[model samples]
Target: MLKREEVESLVEKPAPQFVRDVLEHPPFRVTPNTTLETLVSYLRKFPVDVVPVFKSVFSDEIAGVVYPHTGLLIKSKKLDVKIRDFINSPIIVKESWKIDNVLEILASEAKWGAVVIDEEGKYVGVVTLRGLLSALLLREPKAKSVAAVYTPVEEKKSRVGYVKAIERLSKIFKKLAGGEVEGYVVLNREGGVAGLLTVWDLIKSRRWFKGGGEPRPIFGRGAARGEGRAVGVARVWRLMFRGVAVASPDTPVDEVARYMATTGLYLVPVVDKEGKAIGAVTAWDVIYAYLYGPKEGREDVEVKRAVEIPVAKPQVEEAIRLRPSRHVTGLRARDVMLTDIPAVNMRDTLSRIRKVFLRTGSNILAVVDDEGRVVGFVTRRDYVTYIAEKSLGYWKRQKGKWLILREQAMPGEQAKVLVEEGTAADVMKSEYPTASPDTTVEEIAYKMLAAGTDYVVIVDEKNAPIGVVTKDELLKAFKERGRSVKVGELMTPADIASAELFSSLFSVIRKINAYELDGVVVKEGGDIRGIVTVDDLSLRPVEESLRGERLVFFTKSGVLRRVRAGLSRLRYSKAGALMALDVMRPFDHATNPDADAREVVDRLLEQGVLPVVGDDGRLIGVLNKMDVVKELARVYITYAMPERLKEAERVEVKSK
Candidate 1:
């Protein structure tokens, strides 16, 4: 409304409460014409996963963001691949934007780096977490909650596998995401950390757009069974950035900080001398620890100290309890109860329950009563088992494709009805442990170990739900004991079960189940060749063997009956190639007997027991995940809990 000079004088000089503050130092940027080689080199130079893409050299206008991880995911080559092929249009912003809002974008799992543009759309500079942290160094992170900063990897997260497409690893990642899953831990065949894959690495997993490459041929491995076919899925071994870097618990915190800062790693896994991952530390953990750790318990605000123990105590009573407890220490029902539980209602449908799963990103759901008291428990696996059983029942009733079509075509059909109507009350198991918050942690640990459950619920004085105690928490209770333990000490050393590589799949599955073993190995002339898992054989039968028109042509529009399917020409295409060697993918994980108990437990926590190697690298024993839990529970309660009790008493007295 005023003259230009008057308006300029009246309006105060612009100040930045946004990325422009940290971007005062002109940040790094790439151009759409940047080659993959040069772009990758630039990315390595900066401490961020993504780089801003400018429109051109002269304009300095930001077009989008380019992620280096995208390059890692592509298997095809365009001889002419350039930055333009992958840059994502960064959510545009103004020079006067608020940091709180901009942070929402930078904090997203899908986004970590963004380009800041002037109101005119000119590329101002790029802002990243690294820059944010650097700008934030002068301000103490005292108010940040403990969970936001601490990164701990209980023994279970150390599990790893050979590189596979992120799709193959999605289910496991989902299960882990429900809890505190340490992203993808890639291990070579020998069970050593190889490559790491985090959620960010997977954000751009889309196949190179319209990228050139013929579909990989199935059974291209020169199998004796399939003369010509395509069978295999894409793997990410080549795509995964390799060279694992691990730290030890004793490694100085500063050293870990420096390592993470330089590498731009969010997670730095702690490894033992033998290269077994034992724990993990995050970059933020170091920042919070150094800048604000000393200000804990100041009474200004609720503060979670470096170790927010599962069992928190009142300051005065807590210090007193740390002293010796002369009273009898029989474990009660409350100490280890789960105080926080994620639950759904009884009448909730599968679709509704799934909503809760997505929102919370958890696998387990506790069904509760009107009073919020524990009533039942459910997990992602329960839904799968129920669906599989229901499908089996339907298949038993409806025999063929024609019947399946009719049943699926209409509503209120036979498949529409279900026992319990797929309600929470139907799928939830009511046979879980319940206790007050005061129950002895030992009792709960024993129950968890015996029932093979990962958690137990905690109720209040009014019999209402309060919390939940998980297996990982109990593992923390045994933290000190874990340090002194060895895998050989906890595992039941047993002979390795085996069969020849060329054995029939049926025979291999038989041995795997009959021996009640973790898994069996494929051998050649008394020498170890590879490993096989039970999962390889339990898949759908060979009826749908041939792809494209080959099988359809022979079956005459799929009219061939189930019994007659074997007689069709499709049977000759690649059906019985299900020999053990051909059907089984080589086991990608393993551990040695001398490895630490924590590392071994991490591997065992996954579905199968890893092959226990001797110094000579021959399988000698198997450490089942459940078996380890059982043994640890017994030893930990009888041995470890008592010591913790003593320490608790001592701490209690000191506080008093």
Candidate 2:
């Protein structure tokens, strides 16, 4: 029983302090004379965005700023260079300035952090977007549930299967890596949460045969001597993490965040009382909660306010004129859609579909009719499931049980027959989400989530597919709404996970799995040779191997060697052994350190990780989706929807 005025007061109460309250005192300082090598060491020890540079140790006078990313970019031979040679001008702000004013300055000028000064212009401390957002979240009242910010299980495109499906590891790998989803949830026969499987599990399970004597060479040719079974052959139950951390829908957002931060877990499955996964609470969700508060119910106050207040005729007209009648401001589907995606005819054979998927590295493709009008969509999962079913049927014809197939052999002939005869229309999904070129990114995001799809086909007036927007494009648009941070500011250190040119494939797989990395840079003599990603390891090779095809191998003598083997026989190869040149994509898709993070996101949408290069063309750092998401959370806290709209309008006006 609160009065109307009291409720209004509660809604309009002044927020807590934002700028000075979140000032961060850096652990150390550097002199302008510090060597690039010294700065690199300091950055490694203390992972701060920016380190203050002073004229001397005793002097409080600020010079410039140096960050870890730029320091790492310095060539090994040039480590002796002084810090002054590559310093960035610091954005200075007074402690007395209001939060909004500071935010405006930071949003427009600073890339990573700003130098805080007192009224007398003396250095006080430093303030980063992340620090400010953390302070704001800490001050916020804790009443919201994790559900308010979590991505529902449907939206995550999570695949659920019985624990007994552990034998279908090869098929599972195809589903996991070939689509938007990254993890799989294992359930008991009763549909209770049993375990979890991820790409890390697949990579870690890869092993070389140690006990088996020399394998017989195929066709009397040199075979991979120590090559063992493929990760696809490993039992899923053995590879999957046994226990899963879970949260309830009603769990407090803060509590979930605390657990994730403490346990170093990025995703927590939200389950019901019956132990059924309903959704997932990820670190990004917690960040969203902290920045935007609750996801729903905020519009109710605005609606009520509009109803209570009397609008003047002129004001009403002005509001109507200003409101967007169609698509809202910001990025639209046309701006982010991919026009070069592969499409296939409905009558096309499954073999053609498989070739297209492997050649283009696409998870989904449009299925078109005689008139070239899109009739449906076919995904990697669809193809794999179809082939698996055929194989199972063939095995049953032999009076065999599914359990026996695990220890004996897969029915490769059945899968081959389906690939050679089955048509796209046999397995294509007809009902899918659709959008127009003019649709806003926000609307597309909702459509994707509602439809539980990774992509939405953008169609023309005739319902012909013109372009397609995927989750990667939507994520990029969301990132653009945040502060325009630089790629260098958000990228992770590259040294943590990397591979040498001649390193064993098993070694590379072990490194990537141990670090849970999407990819690792391949370096030769301290120079980047190329990059390898989980997709490179999982997509074409595993699919081709599972089909029992003769894998072509190139010998060091430039001779063509074709080995009719499965994944098990090809496991023990060097990084540069089997089509390494073709396996690794060229490193030409790199971005400069000073490039906008959105640019990095764009590149990462195609490449799992993007290299950040310095002015001298040396690799600085690497960026991924998670890196951008972390910074996006901080930017959301700095600017609300209204502020973002205003900024967009300003840009539009300038464009005009």
Off by over 4 Å in 1: 1-340, 348-363, 369-374, 380-421, 438-441, 479-483, 492-588, 600-609, 615-618, 636-656
Model 1: per-residue Cα lDDT over 9-99, one tens digit each: 7875443356667553223556788776565444333325446667887666667776545444333444456777776767665656865
The best candidate in terms of TM-score = 1
Ten-residue stretch with the least lDDT total in model 1: 394-403
lDDT agreement with native, every candidate: 0.47, 0.55
Error of 1 at 381 (Å): 5.2
Q: Candidate 2: TM-score? A: 0.29
Pairs that clash in candidate 2: none
Which candidate wins on lDDT? Answer: 2
Question: What CA RMSD would candidate 1 show?
Answer: 28.9
TM-scores for every predicted model: 0.32, 0.29
Write the residue-wise lDDT of candidate 2 on 35-67 in tens digits. Answer: 866765554434454578998999989888864
Cα error, candidate 1, residue 242 (Å): 32
